[model samples]
Structure formats: structure tokens, C-alpha cells
Target: MTDKQRTDRGTREYRMGELAERAGITVRTLRFYRERGLIPPPRREGRIAWYDDHHLARLRTIAALLERGHTLSGIADLASAFDSGRDVGEVLGLGEPSEETPVRLTPEALSDYFEGETTAENLSAALDLGYLATDGDELVHISRRLLDVSSALVKEGVPLSAVLAAGREVRGHAEALASLFVELLRPHAAEGDLQRLRPLAKSVVDAELSLALDRRLRGS
Candidate 1:
């Protein structure tokens, strides 16, 4: 805070016991955390040390995060993520977080395309696969890439069922690919290996996907 703001706010601070009560934690836990260097001690006035709401709020956040299975060190890493501006989701293993775009579709075209044959389950699965979306009671192909590929496959006499089967198989392959990397790294990767692993894994995955796409297109 600005010095003026701090002064105007009277440096509103709380003692260890008071802050821990406010944060729904035990004073002992807070003291232990301080001792472990997971949390820094408050500033002192003679013999008394005091904490502010910033510290209380941060502690509460840390507690919530720990309940979510994050280590104290992991919580510190997350707190630092704001300043670093790196892939927070990558660090959290929550995938690349992104905004969802609502795709539009029209019902009449969807009815014509599906011949009024699409089940609700099929429609939901199609949406999950980026194949279709609700466009006013019509399932609409939201992705031109998927539409084009499926069109070519249909022309080549491959049924939609076979295409869906292949999709499930590919998903299994992705799981296997992930397992392979985990096994490879489990024995020797030190802490903070994700930075090195991320680019390596991305490159390998992208290359594999590219070659797989080409192989599929060429009927291999």
C-alpha cells in the first residue's frame, strides 16, 4: 500500500492469536508455519510482533490451498506466480486455462445434417469432441476442421461409428503417452523439472500428433 494509505488505515494489524482466530486457524499452526519459514514473522514493536490483514488473508489462502492438497512450498510457488506471470495452470496441473468461446449454430441445418437422428447423448458427446453445438435446437458443426475431415472419411465409406471408435482409441493413446513420460521422469527428475519437461513434452506431443494426422490422412 502507499504510505499515505497505510497511515490513513492506521496500519490495521492483528496479533498472532487474533489473526489466527480471524483466519480460522490455530495460533500454534501459525507459529509452527513461521518457524518452518513457510510464513514470515510479523514486524516487532519492542517485544510484540503484529500481522496485518494481508498476512491473514495470505494465510487463509494458504490454508485453503493446503486443503486442496497443495504443499506449503507449492502455496509459496503459487503466490509467486502472480509476479512471474508464467503458466499458472501448468504449475497446478490443471491444464492451460483459457476463456471459453460460445459457438453459434442454427437448428434447421442441424436437423438436415443429422436427419433428425441424433440422440441427446450423441449430441453431448459431439459437443465434447468439438463436433457440434446447440444452435437453437439444432446440432451444428462448430469446427470446420472436424467437419471437413469427417466429410472426407464419410466419402471414403468409413462410418461415423468407426470414426468415434478411433477417437476413443486416440484418447487412450494420449493416456499411454502421459504414462510413458511420467515413468521416464519419476526416477530422476528433481524438483522444478517441469520447466525442462514442459517444452520437451510439448515438442514430442506436437510432432507425434502431426505425424499421426498425416498417417491417418494417407490411410496408413
Candidate 2:
């Protein structure tokens, strides 16, 4: 890998030995993690398994969790939960996420995404906020829309910290909106109806927020 590529944390394919070296783990430990289902199975090409950046990210996350006082079993569970999207879907009960795929960012890539606002303190804060999770050497964001919006705000001269703070406030409001919709739907709506009608809540919020912004800009 070139210096730029090595530092950028974008896509790269690796053999078993290379993956272990990149992740700073021994081959045996890598194998053990695979056995424990911490990392997904690699693509098979004949007899050789090919690992990718995703696997590397996961390995780095496991290491970070270990440093954070998580046992292997706990990390395993966390990995499984995140990978399965169960935490995002069920535990959070947020219904379908916005029409955006998850984003996996390396620390460096995340800096690039947020325009160098990714300080160590901010990173730790993001981890604490559950907005980010470490995987081997990458950060996993569960929502592409959120990542894009935060980065856009940073580009517009908003501080990353401020954006995150706003996100925290927005989370409360979002939960309230969700609860309102659920309660409103519960009496006559079936589960499928609840799912189908969820978007109406977001649409109402979006339209109202647009009008609010328009009024504010017009000094009304």
C-alpha cells in the first residue's frame, strides 16, 4: 500500500497474514476471533480466504473494546448486535432507518469526512455517545444520513462538537415523535399499519421544520 492509501483507511483486500499484520494481531488470535464469530467469514477463493477492510475494521473495534475494559465475550456480543442491526432496529425501536446505508469510516477517513474536526477528545465523546463504534481501525456509523448531515454542518462552519450536541437534543425530540406516532397508531392500527404509517411522522416533522426555518429566515 502507498503511504496515502495506508493512512486513508479505504478499501483494501488482504490475505490472512496481511490482515493479521494490518490489525496488529497474531494469526492465531485472528483465527480465534473468527471462531468466536467476532468477525465475519472471509470470501473464499479456492482454498484461500480473502479479507477486506470490513474485517480489519472489526478487528480494530475488538481491540478498542478490550482497551475499554470489555471482555472478549462482551465484545463478541457487541459485535454481533451491531452486525445484526438488532440494536439499531429492535432495541432502539426506531423502525426503518432513513434510506441510507451504514457507513464504515477509519479514524483518518472520519477526519476526512468531518474535515479534520475529529479530535481525540471528540472521538472519545462520539464513542461515549454511541454515535461511533470502533472496528479494528475503522469507525462504524449506523446511519449514512446522519454521517452526511453532520459532515455537511461541519462544512458549513458549524463546530463538530456543536453538531453532536444538537444531535443529542434531536435524539430526544425524535424519540418523542416516535412515541407519539406509536401511541396514535396503537388503538386501531395493526403492526403492519404501524410500520407503514411511521414515515408520516417523519414527513410531518420535515414539513414543519422546513416552514419553521423559512419563517426564521424571513424574520417572521
| Among all candidates shown, the one with the greatest lDDT | 2
**Full-model lDDT for every candidate:** 0.55, 0.72
Score residue 105 of candidate 2 by CA lDDT: 72
> Clashing pairs in model 2?
57-135, 57-136, 59-136, 60-136, 61-134, 61-135, 61-136
For 1-220, candidate 2 gives per-residue lDDT tens digits of 3211221456667888889999999999999999999899987768868788788877886786566555777666655544533233332245434564667775445656865575545565566566776544445776888888988899999999998888889889988988888998899888878778877888999999999999999996
Question: How many clashes in candidate 1?
Answer: 0
Clashing pairs in 1: none
Model 1: per-residue Cα lDDT over 67-141, one tens digit each:
655566654543443222322222223532132223334332332344322333434455555445332222345
TM-score to true structure, per model: 0.34, 0.57
Candidate 2: list runs displaced more than 4 Å: 1-99
Q: Best-fitting candidate, measured by TM-score?
A: 2
